[model samples]
Target chain A: MEPIKIKLDKSNELLTDLMPRKFGPQGRLWVGFLLLVIIIGAVAYYRQLKHGLVVTDMRDFTSWGIYISNFVFFVAISLVGSLVSAILKLTNVAWRTPLVRISEIIAVAAITFAAIIIIVDMGRPDRFWHLFVYGRIQSPILWDVIVITTYFVVSCLLLYIPLLPDIAVCRDTAPASPRWKKRFYTFLALNWKGTSKQYAIIHKSINVLAVLVVPLALGIHTVTSWLFATTYRAGWDSSNFGPYFVAGAFQAGCAGVIAVTFVLRNHYNLRKYITNKHFDNLGKLLVLLSLIYLYFNINEYLVPGYKMKTVDGEHLHSLFRGSYAPLFWSVQIFGMILPIIVLLFKKGRKPLPIFIVSILVVVGAWFKRFLIVIPTLLHPFIPIQNVPESWHHYVPTWEEWAITSASLAGALLIITIFVRLFPIISIWETTEEKMNATATQTGDQTQFYGA
Target chain B: MDEEQSNSRRSFIKTGLITGAIAAGGLGIMEVASQDTSKKKGDTVKLLSPDGKIVEVDSSEINPQIPDSLISTHNVREGVPGKKFVMVIDLAKCKNAGRCKSACSKMHYLPETRSYIKINKMQDSDKASPYWMPTPCFHCDNPPCVKVCPVGATFKLTDGIVGIDNDRCIGCRFCMVACPYSARVFNWDTEYQINVVRFKEIKEHAACSTHVTGTVEKCDFCPTKAAKNELPDCVQACPNGVFYFGDENEDVVSNGDETVRLSQLLKDKSGYRFLEDLGTKPRVYYLPPVDRQFPFKDVEPGTT
Candidate 1:
């Protein structure tokens, strides 16, 4: 009761400030727009289903189109959950409390869509159950399926465990206007009383989940890379793909966090919680990730470019100066190198500039996946032969465009709904951080949180 | 044939090949099935049913107009047991005559836009000669395509043919990407592309190998023909005898007219597999384009 009084006295301001609020007019508009996009995507997917994947421009030569790359993009960005929450949490970064929930939201949204887009790309989605019924352990795709499911589960638990206290807070503090919303909060709150035992369980569960997510995150992206690397395709035939894809994923994920954080910060007026300092720290982290990604990119492309073996040469040529050159170069310069260069300067790491840079990084990350999947497919070992002229080049039709756009929009919608339903930041953790800072002089916080 | 003429002929085949057995109340099926187009086919087909019984079927059963209960997945995965089929393409004799492509497409009921084989006009370098290398699915012993199939949809049969069970295929196209030879083709918009040519349903039957709407299709090495102890459509249809198909266990290959010892032909012609460095161990071997049969020329797939 004494500790309750202390927590109440300190966190009264934060509880009211951080409790979930109703969306503004702009927020409603945004949600409506996402719904519309999702509907359009649904229609497109329906058409694609009714007809076969031939609705896409994917032919024999370019059997995989933007749907695959978009799936890769979703997987890549989904890594943000582990990188921001798990890595930063384990490293004892005190500032990571405010960012973890957003990263998890993004991870959940993006990973959910990652699974969806893969099914959309499937030729026989009706037979998707066969992957489980008759799945081969030897196949890299099955490995991708296994790790992706595991990562999705881990990410959900990571997001949920940390959210229990917040859900309880929302349940207790929420205005009882909507009965179902209150019931949702109550059901998800899992009867949390915020006792020392409850807190202990929360902390212990979070630590385990955080530790478990790192490898699953890395494994998901690595297995995804193996889907290509296991093949002998010229561009995908490297041993470097696993680490390379992991590095690129981290880079894209970090940028995704920053970009979404910027939007949330502006839209929700969360500047006080997500400060300039947070942006600067994230920018610095993004720089490190970009440098690591650039190193792997060089290793992935340079050695092969240097050797220029016949197959790799044809593949690399298509990337370097061929049809894909402009995209490949732009993704390199803007996605990895530019972010590294821009974020190196302290001023550039500020909120506005870094937000713009993060947008560029995200867009470039998307096209980067395109460059990875498409150009290699076009340059298989056998010469492109007497197939129709249309098969020679892959141009994704509107159906593909609609579906991809919808998935992206669907992820945004998930995040938006999550923000509306709960506080975007970890309310309990943020209050704890505040209490820790304020009670340091009195040494009163140690007694309550020390366990 | 005119419209009425072709319709009447197809019904004649339907009754003569299958219903004629029912007309006789299921007695003496073999004799009744052989009443019409069977003798014209010149070879009788021996079908192994789902249960292990080798019964003689009329060759007229190969007709496309029959309602599509193509091949049993349970039966053909083991393939004509003890026979490891092989193909040898003599690069020397190829003049880019595309009868093989047409015959294969016609046999497989492929549309005008797609074929199982492609005659690649390959030039080694500026200094070396260009050759017409017709590439089909190699049915490699160490097949990259089969290894990557997540659902065991495409598999290597005991007869050295890589069979695709389209019923089981989830159509991820991972096999299509895994193949180095670029041999696999997706049935992209099967309903549309098939409607365009009005080709009959694919009856290639490399063990449940009918072209499902959203699955992978490829050169199944004409396992259906081989099941009947005949050369593949490409081998029989090649005008210049450039394509030789046979059995490796038998160590003999024939180009419809000439039978030769497989080892002797490879030894004399310096036969080798294409892209041998990749270690795919292809069932198809190639004798280099030397001592030219006709001058090397660039040719389209459906052109002379």
Candidate 2:
């Protein structure tokens, strides 16, 4: 809870250093690569639209495929915006200042794709308007649509309102920037001269949004989980799915932040700003989130393991010892248990080791969504019959893989582009923290002498 | 008054014969009218008018062709009033001939890959004897498909049949997941090989009963046939009299050849519904396979 103390000269140095910088050759290549991947995905999606959902490996048996899993992953990763910004801000956490913008950018990007991937999964995308034309309140899909859109709007506001002052700073400092870039910043900054009234309004709006985003973020992920849990299928039919999904989402979001922080720190050379202490703190938070998720995983799996209801028994067997066992156990051990074990130690909480652990958590979380979706569908109550042998199993086709990878790349591209335009770390907030620390330190010295 | 009645009755008979001839002959009314000019004028055929009153007219006046749009768009949602349809499968009579499956496939124009009525080989446990179980849509009173459909594309009618509106279905396939019976199938690819001409003919007879690409389809309990008081295709197609279709409200069911009181048949045969404990309240009941028609020899539970 202690504010970070810094000299005025160092504070000014941090501000100028963290300003939006021009992309170097490596940054240009990365953006180009992302664009190429996105184009490939668009082409694949075009083919899907031209033909139908038939291009995918999904059949009557495994009706939902990688598209849905990708959607869940996006929604999961997006929860970090609220966790790192809204939750930490409200709780008076001081160390979260450097990571907030990165998390919010990631959230906005991931959520944008989360909405798109859902449409990509639809059988009749042309008739998507039918959802609005004949939407029923009873359907969980409608609830998801409502909450996700609400979350997306709230998240965008949360990302943008805080960026106003920083945008003003970029506008004032970057006179040599491109005409369009200057115009963009000028228009976006709303002519802010850092007046006290302007600051008050901006602060009040952000505070209101920060409070609003927490429950909306929770609702977005909880409702995404409900899309599956509301169903009668054995693996998906559990009251624990809501909390299970939220916990897993927090874990995944924290891992995303850790991964992004490490990259941004190296790429932007902001080592002085994003210190090892931030990684250590995030590492500990990851441990707590992973533990909570592990508890839910136990609750999710144990009851079915104990009762072994005929339908549930078959589903659990597939995850525990049958076809999905490798992916299942790997997700459990590496994604949850190993991360928990590694991050619990001081040495492992260091930046390098923790980054590795975060990568494992992320990759494992992606496959965990896959395990949740595909396995249960394969073990329907009735045995698979009268269908082609290929229908008996699901292997996502190349087109499906292309589209799913494109969505992931698309999320990354959005983050990359946003970082190119703005500071990954909040300059105004960091400076405010430094000033507060100075005030607190002088007050402590005064008290010591008087006593 | 008597003389007037006799005149009207004669004319009604004449109209009835002309209409029937045109329908049976598949000849256009204009062709028939032109041909009638060369025929003998003395011939008279008995006919009845739709109004129950007879009106004398030349046979040439009969128009056999009805406008396609005049084909009634009877609200398929409101089923046959005052009727609760049910089916009772006599498992004791089934011998795995797959006649019901083929008949159902043919009647519904289902592709060779899919069958609306599937004949599953079932055994309760490893120690139990296996038997052929022909499974169709249970038409549950509390259907999970109807409940989960976001657009009300699939619905359970009052007549105990669950039907799908292909035009309205957004093809989410949530209903397929909700259905425990695995009765539903998606029209994944466009069925280009379907006999479009025959399909069109069938569509004229049945409202909202055309298949489309990317929508879910399943056994509809042959509501089209049921509306006509005719046996569903599977009921009539089962050579061994395995399927009985009837109105549960009347408590009578017929297996094409023989009619039986439903309550009495169930009482005598110890009938039960599939997965009764699931509380789906299926309209289809099964008489358990006892006193088997064929031995459970060399037959696997889920193999053709």
Candidate 3:
């Protein structure tokens, strides 16, 4: 089949209807809530700065805590953009068109926050520039910096390039916009005139970025995983870390896309454009990704679990039977296993159930990162001695919670601002898709008549 | 009036004797306000040579240089010239007395919870018996910490000791996390200046009067003493003379009074570097904990 096409006359109301709109009451409330969370988080960070890292419960032994986990969580979730858009596009998956824009948005939002959260985890955020000026190639942290910056740039361009035509639509149709808003739209549209040459360039650039970004996306999270894995600590010393982290990243990324897709579909009243068919396809993709992740997870844990080296045993015991057991199992089951079960059933694959499952998967993946970081540090081979007892255990204080929550809020605020300025779904892409679908239907009808 | 004048003279003589004891031992007074009695007349002293011949020399010739009466505190931190300092720890003598740990903590104003030095109870292999292994920063010739430091905050000194410039340290703790020996400690919380200094004249020397949060700390080897031509506090404080402070340039090491050739002492004691396989080439050599003065017994763990 050629493609499904919808009518796209210059005067078509759907074209104008889908242009970026001013916020309604619900949009206002959402923006307000995100702002509130961000402000609270900023205040918390201020306290941390004034009082020092003592505001957090992190001590010498468990030096890393939830902030680092949250950083991993953001990096993992950001990987979904490349998986959904680039990987699917490369493999000729037709259903990804509607889902692609939101995935890229989440990618940009999550990656931006990932960078922010990692800085927050630093004892001296002020000295972050030192990383660039004096970076050592041998350190895994430097590798992460290089790849993550590359991923962010690629993700932003992926989000931006295809947006030109849509921004043009917004520029032309936005009625009596403010002077600055008009200029903003016009500049962003890059004078895109829907010419064959412009369309061809836009499509080609998207293709190139999609291809370049996939490996870089994978590289970013893999390198982030190595920050821990490269060490000699019990839980971190894994040969399987690269693949394990990549699999987990795709799982979280796919789940994030699903959750964002659900919210966008409802918020924009885009039931017709997004459709049940799109959700069904997404549900299947998520289930398959979850299963693949589960396979890698087994490889990560089971092989080491069997041998039970002295250091490994201490670390595994904490996650499996000791203080961290509850979180450890819950992340495995709810983050991976339960989502897999839900996605298996057709009813569970529907939009509403899939949305709920995606939320569960995301929450579970966050805790999974926490399990990866904290427990390993706690189980350092040497006995903990000669320090205050508090140094032996890690518990996040209010300031840590505030700073961490603030980073999450900051990501949400970005998404909120993005939605306010541009249509969450691409109006121009949807119009083009509709036109192609109609043309294909007409071609099929002509074929039947000829036969 | 007469009694006060006599009291002042007696007190002056007492001061002279105390000053004479330290000055006579090559701790020179570079400047003295008193009139030069030696300039009035050429006084000569007779001394016997090692070969038992008598020699006559001017009294001034007995002292080659007038050392600074008081080495400036800032200058003391700069270390001595023309020597690269090194240390050797005799593991055989360490019974985990942990006096070195406490003294270092007190001097550096480290928090009670943080220790720059850790005494690891290391077992060579699964089947081998355990031994008490005290670990200071190996201060590796090719230090992993110096390599990973994003800022040049932690640097290796020309004298072979690695030290941190606290003002430059951003306290990322990357150095702490990177160190394989677990030799690095972070100031995760600010430390209270506990007034560790005493003596009115020396109070000005205490620049470590405040501890900033978010910096890394480790064993400095008391550069403060190396400038004074004295052994590091750890080398001096060890009752069993476990630590040997030396200059590799001179090929001589001394634990306070007994000085010996560095190469000779190492050869005699069969000194070895710890974790030799790691390729760090540690400055501190170790003497094995064999033929010990005391039997190995498990000490109950405590937050010393």
Candidate number of the best lDDT: 1
Q: Which ranges in model 1 have alpha carbons more than 4 Å from their true place?
A: A1-11, A442-451, B1-74, B192-208, B301-304
Interface RMSD of 1: 1.7
Model 1 Cα lDDT, one tens digit per residue, A247-270: 999999999999999998887777
TM-score of each: 0.88, 0.86, 0.82
- Backbone clashes in model 1, listed as residue pairs: none
Chain B TM-score against the true chain B, each candidate: 0.73, 0.72, 0.70
In candidate 1 the C-alpha lDDT for residue A350 amounts to: 93
Candidate 3 segments exceeding 4 Å error: A1-13, A442-451, B1-86, B111-114, B120-132, B192-211, B227-229, B247-281, B285-304
Local accuracy by lDDT, each model:
0.83, 0.81, 0.75
What CAPRI grade goes to candidate 3? acceptable
- Give per-residue CA lDDT, model 1, range B1-304, as digits (tens): 2335445644654675565454442322333344444446557788765346998876755432221111212343446656899999999999988888888777776765567888888988999989899898999999999999999988887789998887799989999999999998888775623432232233244233446788998987876677657788889989999999998886889998898889889999999998898899999999999999999766564642
Q: In terms of docking quality, how is candidate 1 classified?
A: medium
**Where does candidate 2 chain A have its weakest 10-residue lDDT segment?**
A442-451
Between prediction 1 and prediction 3, the one with superior TM-score is 1
Q: Write the per-residue lDDT of candidate 2 for residues A1-451, one digit (tens) a residue.
A: 3333223343578656787777899999999998998899999998888777888999988998889888899999999999998999999887788899999999999999999998888777777888899888788788888998998898888888888878887787667657888898999988876766776787788899999999998899898888888777879989999999999999999999999999989889887778877888999999999999999999999988999998899999989999889889999999999999999999999989999999999999999999989888988777776677899999999899999989999999999888888878877777776576567775532221121
Estimate candidate 3's alpha-carbon lDDT, on a 0 to 1 scale. 0.75
Q: Write the per-residue lDDT of candidate 3 for residues A350-447, one digit (tens) a residue.
A: 99999999999999988898899888887765666656667778878878887788888888788878877887777667666656656676553222
